[model samples]
Target: MELTTSNPAQPHGMTWLRDDRYSWFLAGMMWVLIVLMIVPEGFDYQRLATASAPSSGGPISRMLWLLLLALGIMMVSWRAGLAWLLARVLNPFFLLFVALAIVSVAWSIDPALSIRRLIRLGTIVLACVAFVLMSWHARRYQNVVRPILTIVLLGSIIFGLVFPALAIHQQTTPELIGAWHGLANHKNGLGALACISLIFWFHAWLTREVRFLPALTGGAVAVTCLVLSRSSTSLAATLFVMAVLLVLLRSPQGLRPYMPYLVSMLVALLLIYTLAILNLIPGLGTLMAPVTALTGKDTSLTGRTEIWTILSEHISYRPFLGSGYAAYWTAGPVPGADSYAFVWRMGSFYPGSAHNGYLEIVNDLGWIGLLCLIAYIVVHIRQSLQLLEIDRHQGALFLALFFQQAITNLSETHWFSVQSVDFVIMALATTALARSLLEHRLRLVFGQPQPSTIGTSHGMALPLARESFDRTPDGGA
Candidate 1:
């Protein structure tokens, strides 16, 4: 598509509106992508008995997703072109991870399922790349992100209040009774959404990027949803993430140099504490038993430990490779094949996940894939840290998201997902991080100061989308 143009004879408001059409389109695509994946499935007790999550809406929802994604890809191709998007999507470590996932299909107990899932994951990744390109290149990251989150966050409250049967937890388990699932399938999902919403709006408020009243309202609603959801892990993760953000972003100037060391020490302490609470540290767990009980969970962590133990035994059977990418939890076993036995062992409470992200990877792709994942995470984090030197707010936002995902995965499987909100957000953050680092490097090498996407005051300024229309040496748009 060509750059939208408003003739000089047109009114100023008309010009502005014409110039911003791309921005509105970008935001609209993002809303569709995020909202469809995160929207509630209504309350279904039958889903609790099943091991896997339901598909991400019906055929119409998927068809719409694909249509938007195709348009986004075309826009990116025509405007910024494929080179930059490819650079971000085809990073070496990430490529290796994808390659491993593809290779796993060869050894998969269910090759058909593995290949199907790989296609789904690939489509999600492509959408993420297009999303990042449009948002970052156009300097509309916040414009694209905040409104979608606001809608989802606020809609959760409305849904819960007006349609309690669909939004509130039903009689699935004793512990989940009376809890609000909101716009998610489970209370924990709602808690996680609220936790992230709280963190994001709070950051906007702290940086003064957003005005007080609206930011305060967002944060307040987030807190209310979080409390009503009653997801202990999300609650704990939010507090820790907020504390870290405060120390890093709000600390005195003199303490800036020591911040890294302080943060490392704090993280180490938290890890040790978590290990003890989970009884992973031998005698320390016994000592921390009472403390764990106080948190409304025992060492079993609501039966997650038992699930992990069974999963570990199965993972040992494969050791290096794995049963298959997304094939281990089939609905039924092939005759004479033991691969789908986990579904039965998990009984009626089958959680479709290993309850641990790292373990989930191992169960699907084995130790080699686990290593690939670690490398991918490390590479992106290193780039994000480099971005910190160029833009604090952007870096801090990415870090908050990274840590939140990492922490939540300790007790939930939020990684390697194609449909979850967590996956979508992380994809955006990581892609943006890469784009920022690359742009910073290019500016330094060429000695040209690129215009800042994020304002010096941490606000985002929408650059004229007409910049994408700048003529190349060959007179291309």
Candidate 2:
């Protein structure tokens, strides 16, 4: 009934759905689902020993996926305007990337595995879309995400201290024996979550969205967990994001015009760093000696360089289309088997990922996929800069998270993984960009009319501020 009467001009319809109780309930459920995906308590580490075995998630996970899918369908069906909004907001490059993943199933070395993983990926995408549509209001983004990070950060600290046997990793090598995992399956997972929590809480504090006491407490907890996890990559990424945030907040207006140049330089630097890490550049190891010493890591990067060496050879075989979506890593035919054997022999255990996002994309979907990702990032960065002109606080938050993920992928791959936390943040960034683009277009087509302020009292402000850009008809362009 609501779907039939929904109007584009009155996009925020279904007044009953805007009830405080319903909004909070939806937010809580979505947050819980995200946490479970990132820190799956039922994950079986033993499965890592067998690369060829069919991996199965817990019943709880299966049910959560179904619920998320159902909710996504319901939201899109009930809010026809949301469908229209997404039509204009969704990035074409990202859609092409997803399409390629689906198409890869036909050529996949392990068709069954590809299909299963693709299905899981579809579920995650659906949930992300649902979240974006549901939170299509200014400031709702912070309100929805803040409590989630706070609860997760506090809960992880408490669980790690109270249940060390369950929350801390015990089977790690003697050097990493005391590392804390804290509800996640691995210490690295905990570290990633902590890094994310630190960024969110810090942004909240900087924006004064929450009281000082809670924000400071949450940030402290996040930092402690990050340190205890003993993940050098996470620590480095957290610091990198913080530094970027500091720069952005210091002079957002002055920095806006140079954002494109800044992003390009950052990407170029990352490429050089990657090459250095891979030993492709002679004498690079000597240059990185100081960094290694600071992080207490050897030149091996804990065997990631070796994994990259093996996977690089395999990427050349199917350099165009790849071994299909996540199909090459399994113990299958030819190159897949060879690569798996090499990694197992080198590490005496499963390596799990390519340890590099760019390499992973090439391995899963080939060079075209890699290009699609680059295009997606370029577009996202441009849009985030535009957002900074209007909403400095929210815009800075998006950019900081985007940079953090970019850096994190250098040492850990989560590009297209199902229910991956990094991928989810990327999705959220895409959603924010889409929302901003839609608003700009609307202002252009509809003229600079005052937005209906029906939901402002409920903490939902229509995203129609004209503080950033010129009001000329072609200004949005």
Candidate 3:
């Protein structure tokens, strides 16, 4: 009898797993998942109403997401091994915050609702973790993400033009009458998508990732949608992030050391402006008046400050641990229900959030939760800044996304919302940056070959697996 030795890591008939096919399939699944999230139920109004009920996601969608998570976990186990995957996903702060959310159910005003929302949030975070582990290269990450954003942007435009009744705001508030919601349930949703696409396509153009004409075309589409949606917050956040990205990406290498200081100054200015917009800083309003006017908003920031004032009172009730994870807004979805007391006070409107991420965190998880979230963001920011020294393009992209999220969160809450597209991307970006930084440090310590170089851009090329298993070549990272 011939003695055949087998590797435990690679069981018999597992040769099929040595290719990039799984990566591509996972990327496609991610695209589908994002699409399902941003554009739900074929943009059918009635279906959207039922789907948008308090539960973060419908049953079918949750199951599909979980299925994708399972496939991703299995792929990581087979390709990179669970330990390698864990190294990327075991972010301490993220885990702590999640654990806090889970434990908060004990004190939640509505434990059942908290439990349901917590389940959805858990799925989202895990899905993001899997996306990070499976995405072995920055270029692959961009490839999977860019097209999804572009298609959604373009689809929104087409939807607005072809189905005006469904896509355009109808018998709503006087100011919002003609605003375009497109395939999204709200105009701000469409605007947020457009803003992100604009930033991405612009970055693609800057880095020559896509042809100039195609990038320009994508940006133009995004701009059209942004203008039609009339989402001032998205517009402002998009501009701020784009400016930061341009300075970081286009500046000469000689100025890299000073980039941090420059960015700090910019962030300071942003902080002051955010405070002014929230009416927290009475003095800076005059300084920001011109800029705010350009965005077509009044001193009240379209009544957001008022909402903050009202929500602040509620937050004061449970200032420490919070009302419980997603428990504050437990009222029925009716127009004039008792649960909408805050909403009615704000504007007799339903914004579905505190209009601020920091406030949302405080309201949901309390000051402790806010501290954990800030720590989480700080850790990712440090990683991205360190990444700038190793890979400019990827680092700038990550940093830009972080800044955009920060800016948007000033006027919109996406920090922990299960249905938020921005939160999803932010999670993916955080994990990718963490993985890349960890890999770079490990290589330095182990004296392994530096990460594979691609082009002259100093980009980190992460192979899909260990050299022994990455038999199928990838196009590029």
Candidate 4:
């Protein structure tokens, strides 16, 4: 009679193991970093330093890098619904990356090389999907975004201050004609970084529980770094997002409570305008500093506009699929006798990137692919804007990210290569969350009992928290 068995109570941490939130958070981190490593964050210059082969960096390192990523994702994921939702949201765009690989099957001048590049692109996307499925939560999502802002701000500062100093230190040593190397490859990439980071910090300023001072300082530095990057697109985007911040401050019905934000924005705008009219804005210096440190006169943006013009002309050629993945104007030899005569030419210099992302896509993926990409992003941005309109904090962050992406894709220096990874992952996660939220709102409006969904407060947990979990552990339990 006394042989009754008792079941042990699960600790909170053990229960948390069953919680999709915890599993998803880990998955999200894997999604962010694994894709970044594979996509080659500095391909803008890394390809130049070494041969493009995965072997040039060594086969062992590349193999180990990918194997480790696979193992990590396998170890963490616990849910299948997350995977399917992730796929449903993102599978449409995989067609573009697959199109890159398919191009090699049909038309690679060097089939082997093209196949290799195609495989690389597919692997990156697949890895991104794996990470996104596991880590699809609003809080974990913030972890990935906030660090990105830091990296961009740090990279911008490093380039703005250090690159010029390095050039001056070795100007006469003659290692090269210029030294514009930031932590990343070029200013455009850094500018992309700045643009995204600016939006992120600006969101942090609005949504987080923290005091405003830290976010304000972060926003200023992000804007300064973006301006110093001297990318007109980045500058324009910063201003646009700043406008968004002002709107957020004023949109709340209780305007009197936010008088401080209104006053601060007005002051900031006035000061920035006054300084610019006086020709004192720092971006003006970025144009001259590189050459003045070495020679006398400012160098032209080194024919950037002319090169852009050349790429635009090429867009007419492939009006469909321009060239192929990683294919562009950079591959051809300048064979004319006049070509050899140009004194302005830098040594062995060639750029594969089209500088204009829209043109670049049209060249590589063809008209169909280009149209799909544009439509995909536009739809997501439109949705995010709607979400923000409803004052949903997570939706606002998505809106900020997509807005930055829409701007920086033009005249981008290095973003397309590195950012494909982050783009797909974020896209997968955002769409999943948005869709689930949409379904919930629809059910409530129809007066239908809400359908069960993971992480949904309906059925599983009350929308009103059972009690304050922050109270004493025993009390809450």
Best by lDDT: 3
Q: What are the per-residue Cα lDDT tens digits for candidate 1 across 310-342?
A: 787888899799888887765444334454455
- Please give each candidate's TM-score: 0.80, 0.83, 0.83, 0.62
- Writing each residue's lDDT as its tens digit, candidate 4 over 1-477 gives 000012123222111112243454545444445334423333433453343223223565457546645644563243343343334334354445465546535643345544555555555545555444442344455566556556546654664475554311222323223433244344454456666666777776676734589777777776666655556556666666567665654466665345335434533443343233223355654444532343222322334455554555655665665455553332333444222212235354445455555555665566765676656555565455455444356655665565455544544532234324334435434544454343333223222332223453211121211221222232111
Candidate scoring better on TM-score of 2 and 4: 2
Cα RMSD (Å) per model?
7.7, 5.5, 7.2, 11.8
The superposed Cα distance between candidate 1 and the true structure at residue 25, in angstroms, equals 1.6
Number of clashes in every candidate structure? Answer: 0, 0, 0, 6
Q: Write the per-residue lDDT of candidate 2 for residues 257-349, one digit (tens) a residue.
A: 776577668767666666677666887777677657755676566767778878878887898989899876663333446456664557555
lDDT order, best first, reads: 3, 2, 1, 4
Q: What C-alpha lDDT do the candidate models reach, one value each?
A: 0.65, 0.68, 0.70, 0.46
Question: In model 1, where do residues sit more than 4 Å from their true spots?
Answer: 1-21, 40-57, 72-82, 85-92, 135-139, 266-295, 331-347, 445-477
**True-structure Cα RMSD, model 4:** 11.8
Q: Enumerate residue pairs that collide in model 2.
A: none
